[model samples]
Target: MISKQYRLDELAKQVQGEPVGQSDLKLKRLASLENASSDDIAFVNADKFLDLARSSKAGALIVTEQLRAQLQDVHQNFIVVANPYLAFAILTHTFERKHEQRGIESSAYIHPSAMISDSAYIGHFVCIGENCVVGDDTVILSHTKVDDGVEIGKQCFIDSHVTLTGECTLADRVRIHANTVIGGEGFGFAPYQGKWNRIAQLGSVRIGNDVRIGSNCSVDRGALDDTVIEDGVIIDNLVQIAHNVKVGANTAMAAKCGVAGSTVIGKNCVFAGAVGVVGHINIADNVTVTGMSMVTKSISEAGSYSSGTPMLETAQWKRAAIRFKQLADVPLTQFAKKLDHIQAQIESLESTFKLRK
Candidate 1:
């Protein structure tokens, strides 16, 4: 938690922005427009929020070129960039909390066969199992468990209470948040006679570089092969990625999303919050599934997709539900014939009215 300070010109260069009006202003932190102080920097990405940004007491503001014109009267120092939000994102990393501790704690348990890097930080009560490989500058925080044969790469930040089991292989710069369970057994079972027999999860999880998995998530081990999470995949909290699933590069799954086993989701796809995908489906690249949808089959196109009816009033929804079920009772041919008859009768009445006119 070291204090960080940056000048306006330096941050602007990092974000590829043009610093205007007092380019030498010092910014101590990044904050929201409503909460920023004279030593902080705020950002406004949209015109609707420009009014709020204009009233902010921040020492500097990150604004897009489109918004910079209307903010001419604002007294704060300005950093004009192509995308204000992107500039803010770049600036946030410069001001974020840093991890400075670089040594193993006294209470940690390391197996004799484990090979831990000299520069890695093993926090309080952490356990490293047999033959585990911990790379350089990796931080295995307090109470985390690294099981046998686990291979963790350099500069990874594994938060407290997380479990890495089943000989999972994680690449560099991976950040798994607190309480997440990696390499857990998937929901695999075989129906035998009148009972369910448990199927063995014989595989592990292979995660690529720059992946960020949020807290409370379960990425299950495969039934036979590895569950692969490609590079730059970001998963939010409470999400479930089942066994043998291949999440392609740069894919993002928001909170509460679930992808069933054996699903091959292509690169750069986005699964919004509360979305559910069925097993054994192939989702094409660049597909965006909206919130609260259930993907039952394969998606072959690349576009934004949605399913499920919008919310309605309780009584209205009940009536719609009843009518929806009643459709199963009606024959399609009979309905079409009745509809055609009604259309013919309406056309005859319109012709008669036109003759009278």
Candidate 2:
């Protein structure tokens, strides 16, 4: 819960929403409708939760137009907006715990050649490499490694145990969660006399502004050109982006999705959990891939794509599998010959009937 309280009217102004009922009512914190109290604010975005919202004890509510109309007979304090969930998300920051950073810790190691801003916080046991640059108000948490020539921008948050390899750049407001390795070596090899020779990765990673990368993710460096993640891309935990892959703006990839090397994913694309895309393919803009789908080829148009069969009973599936296996054994030439014989017999019978008539 937040220590500070605000009137319903003040919150309405903050969210640019229309206020109804008692605008002077006080709200302390943000909560779900089912868990809200008299001092809390709750939001209603869908019809399934309307009953829960109606019975909630919240002093103030953020609601959509449909929900606002449904509660017109009731005298509950509410703020109506186009997107109640977005307003609720904005309000969450008011109750979130603020981390107060103390400038560079004594236990941190900083190279004399590195340029660090005065407003930046360098946590204990952190290592900053030579010629590396840390921007203003940026926080490098404990045990994080900043390799040589890495450039991190202002207002960025690098969580604990992150490894930023040499020459990689992060723009402002980029948030990287713990244990994520950026600019790691790409998986490239050349076959030489039945043995594989590793190709050295020479390029780095370039991440744009407002990108959020979740924990334990690995983004590989390119073999020649840099791997680029555009602005406003959100990647969930355990996602793997291969070398030289380009992810377009505002694309959101869920956990465990893997994109093979040199693939170009378009803008506003959504990849659900466990979706796998093959290498060197191009996916068009506004595409949404459902969970556990395998993309073996390029998607040229903007649409929702899915693959793989749905679940079925073992007995039913076995029967279907037998028929599928037998389909290859059918002979087209013999079947056509049998059909021709039946047609000849029918023609002979028709001629005899016509003569008798």
Candidate 3:
């Protein structure tokens, strides 16, 4: 924890915010608007929380320039910025906790041919296989496995119980949370006479820089080609990425979402929680899928997509579900007749009005 205190003017310079009234007030930490004290700084990001901000007892506040006037009469110190939320994000690092671990543990097993940097930290029960390369300043936590021909880049944080299988590659600053399995065998099988034959997984997984994968997520190895996760992709917990799936740069997938085999998702796409994407499809860039939706076909444009109806009472839903199935029995010819009858009635009314005039 950070015990050092900073004046309002110094903090304003760090985030490029304009200091308003009383720049000499000292702040020790950052806190929420409702929980701030006289020594803490707080932020107001939205209009709905204006009342909370007004009532906060924080010595210093961070707010947008547009809302500065609203707080001006309150006689409290503040820093005005173009974006208060972004400024708050920058301030979080000042109070962030650092878990500093150094040196290789005595219980770790390293192969003679494996290369590790002097600056990296290897924890207890770690297994480094032949031809593995651990980069500088990387931290591999306890009970992790780094198999043969694997290369992990600099400044990565691999949590406990992670398995990086043979020949897999991870670029710089990639974070893998606890219990993640990378380069696991894909779901592949061949049909034989009255039996199922297994196909060997020949390819590995390649992850680009700055990717963060959450806990218990499984990224499978490809059957013939590599399964690629591009730069800055963020995956939530319990997600599944199957064989030969190519995810473009900066895409985000929420928790419990699964992408089937050979699906190519474009850049800047967003998949909400529990969204399921089918196999062998291409999704366009900048697409957004709502929560619990099923994507069965390809999206050719950049837009938001959703499926599944809203929830209703159980008894009401049961009746609506019955009517939904009965829709197939409705006659199509009756709709055509109704349209013709309406058109004739309109034409007769028009002719009668003209004769009266």
Among these predictions, the greatest lDDT belongs to: 1
lDDT of 2: 0.92
Q: lDDT score, residue 114, model 2? A: 98
Each candidate structure's TM-score, on Cα atoms with residue i matched to residue i, is 0.93, 0.88, 0.90
The sequence of per-residue lDDT tens digits that candidate 3 reaches over residues 1-357 is 458898999999989999998899889989998899999999889888888888988888899877878877774689999999999999997767655777899999999999999989999999999999999999999999999999999999999999999489999999999999999999888999988899899999999999999999999999999999999999999999999999999999999999999999999999999999999999999999999999999999999999987799999999988887786577878878998999999999999999999
Q: What value of lDDT does candidate 1 attain over all alpha carbons?
A: 0.94
lDDT of 3: 0.93
Candidate 3: C-alpha RMSD to true structure equals 2.7
Error of 3 at 53 (Å): 0.5
Where in model 3 is the C-alpha error above 4 Å? 328-357
Descending-TM-score candidate ranking: 1, 3, 2
Clashes of each: 0, 0, 0
Candidate 1 residue lDDT tens string, 206-315:
99999999999999999999999999999999999999999999999999999999999999999999999999999999999999999999999999999987899999
Candidate 2 lDDT score at position 315? 93
